[model samples]
Every structure is written in structure tokens, then in C-alpha cells.
Target: LAKEGEEGAVPGPDLVAAMAEQFAESANNVIIEEVNKGLNPGMIVLLVVATTLLLFFVGNYALYLYAQKTLPPKKKKPVSKKKLKREKLKQGVSAPGE
Candidate 1:
């Protein structure tokens, strides 16, 4: 294939046919071996992936719920800038005359 590219030759019909046959034979052998082993590697991999994703989603949801329940509720307060300034001025004021 490398020599073919160097020779400026594109894969013609015959080359395509031969390559297809070679790939098909290899694929058939792989399928047969997997069947003999009685364990579909592809299905196992897919199952593991699905299980991992499910666990991740469930775990995150559980953690979110747990955090919400354990955390303290915030106090409701009506804030005002004037109130804050008054508090600061109060802190700065002197008590008796010098």
C-alpha cells in the first residue's frame, strides 16, 4: 500500500476487492473466537459503560439532596444601605466629653 502510494497509483477495483476480502476474513475469525469464548466483549463493555453512567447520575443526585438537607436554612432579612451607615456611625461615636 505504501509502495502503491509512492508509485502515484490509486487503489483500483481489484485492489479494493482484495483488501475487502482480507478484512472480511479477519473479522470472521475474530467473531468465531468470541463466540467460542461464550462472552461477548462488546456487550460487556457496553454494560459497564451504562452502569458507570447510571451510578454517576444517581450518586450526584443523592449528594445534592444530602447537601440540601444538611445545610442550614438562610435567614430572611430586608437589607438597607442607610441602616448599615447608621450602624457604622454608632460604632465611631465617643461616649463622654474629653
Candidate 2:
């Protein structure tokens, strides 16, 4: 009876160790699978956003360059203080000092 009870008892240390190892392998596989599943899409989204921002800036810069090329050069009329005083005098305006 005693031998039969011992034989029918729970598994030994080796079986327990094997079971623990299998459980660890399964847990590792699950962790790896989850990380892979999450990482791929996350990286894709990040790349898309980064690419969009890069293209946006590049396109804006291109448009800026195009506008600069197409626009006419600005001409600034040079006016001296003497010219302004002469014009004011012509318009019958008094000078600063009486």
C-alpha cells in the first residue's frame, strides 16, 4: 500500500523543473509575440508621421524657392532728407526751425 501510494504521488523534482522550463518558454514566446505585434505597427506609425513632417517641410521649402524665383525684384526709391525738405518747401510747409 505504501509503495503504491508513493508511486501514485505527485511528480518528482525533475518533472517540476521540466514543467517550469516549459512554462518559462511559453511565457517568453507570448512576450516576444506581443512585442512584435505591437512594435511593428508603432514603428510604422512613427515612420509615417516622421515622413509626413519631413515632406511637409520639404514641400514648403520648395514652394518658398519657387515663389522667390518667380517674384519680381523689389525696387527701392532712394530719397534724401534734402529731397523731403525741398518737397515740403514746394508744398508751402515750414521748416523745423523758424
Candidate 3:
């Protein structure tokens, strides 16, 4: 079903943050329940480490993508005609147009 009016609008940062917090809380509760239900300690450690590394890599890649999109392109510094002419003159080379 489609949402109507303000309900269909994009969620702002505050709403997004709250939703994320709530989701995290629920995830934590689930983890805690699994621990209480005799989840292996080694399994928990592995899961934590794997999740951290995955998130780190994904976040790093996302930042690289954002930087690529928002940053300006590298510019080249061209040699000016005046500088080129001076260099040529210092080398005893005469200008063709002169």
C-alpha cells in the first residue's frame, strides 16, 4: 500500500537516527537472548569480529565513493606561453613567429 501526504515524505536525520537506535536495541535484545539460551562464547566473539570488519570495509568503501562524487577533479598546470618563450630564449632558441 502507498503512503499518503506527510507519511510518504522522506525521514529526516532525527527520525532516521531514532529508527536506527530502535533497531540496534532490538538486535541487542536478540543477541542477549541467544547468549542466555547458551550461545557459544567463541561463536559470539567470531560474530562480533566478523560484523565489525564487514562494517568497517563497507563504511570505508562508502566514504571513498562519497569523496569521489563530491570532490573536484584534479587539475593540470599547463606551461604558460611566457614561461615557454623564456625557456626557449635562455636556450638560444629563436621563436618561429618572430
Candidate 4:
């Protein structure tokens, strides 16, 4: 039931649901239908390839994250004199001036 935005429209019949019902009622007792019930060679190969690639990428990313957490911190770089002087000035260590 569509709530009152009223293009004065009744809900249209769902064609997809109608099609699915028609297909489900199909009595196509073909021998090929029985073959599709089991996994095909192409589908098995695709599944194996997909699973392998997924594991490889996920394992690599997991190892990278593990290394990030477990590895020692990098050495600190030396601060430049300009930044140091600015910091000192901010801390009110001024030179002798008006």
C-alpha cells in the first residue's frame, strides 16, 4: 500500500514476481536440468580461482597490518631551527626588545 503521496496511483503488478512464478511453474523436465544440479567444471574452477585470489589479498593486507602493529617506531627526524625558534617565541622566551 503506497502511503498518501497520491499520483492517484494504485500499486502496479510486479512483472518480475509474475515472471518468477511462471518460471517456477515450468515443467521443463529436460535431462540438462539434472546436469545443472551438480557443480560444473567451469564453476568449480572459478570458485577455486576466486577463493585463492581472495585469500592472497586478505593474507597480504593482514600481514601488513600485523607488521605495522608489531614493528618498532621509526627514528624521530631533527626539528629545524625556524620551527624551534617559533615554538620558543610561543612559550614567551622573547629577545630584549620593546
Best by lDDT: 3
Model 3 poorest 10 in a row by lDDT:
28-37
How many pairs of residues collide in model 4? 0
Model 1 lDDT per residue over 2-98, tens place: 5566776688889899999999889867644334666699999999999999999999999999989998998889778677667767999543432
TM-score of each: 0.38, 0.39, 0.41, 0.44
**Top model by TM-score, which number?**
4
lDDT of 4 by residue, 1-98 (tens): 55545675564468558877788778564456344568889999999999999999999999999999999999999998778778878899973352
Tens-digit per-residue lDDT, 1-98, candidate 2: 34424766777688889999999889867644334445588889999999999999999999999999999989899999899889889999986775
Arranged by lDDT, best first: 3, 2, 1, 4
Task: Judging by lDDT, tell me the better candidate of 1 and 3.
Answer: 3
Regions of model 2 farther than 4 Å from truth: 1-39, 74-98
RMSD (Cα, Å) of candidate 1?
9.7
Query: What TM-score does candidate 4 get on C-alpha atoms?
Result: 0.44
Model 4 regions more than 4 Å off: 1-33, 36-45, 65-70, 95-98
Model 2 scores a TM of 0.39
TM-score of 3: 0.41
How many backbone clashes does every candidate have? 0, 0, 0, 0
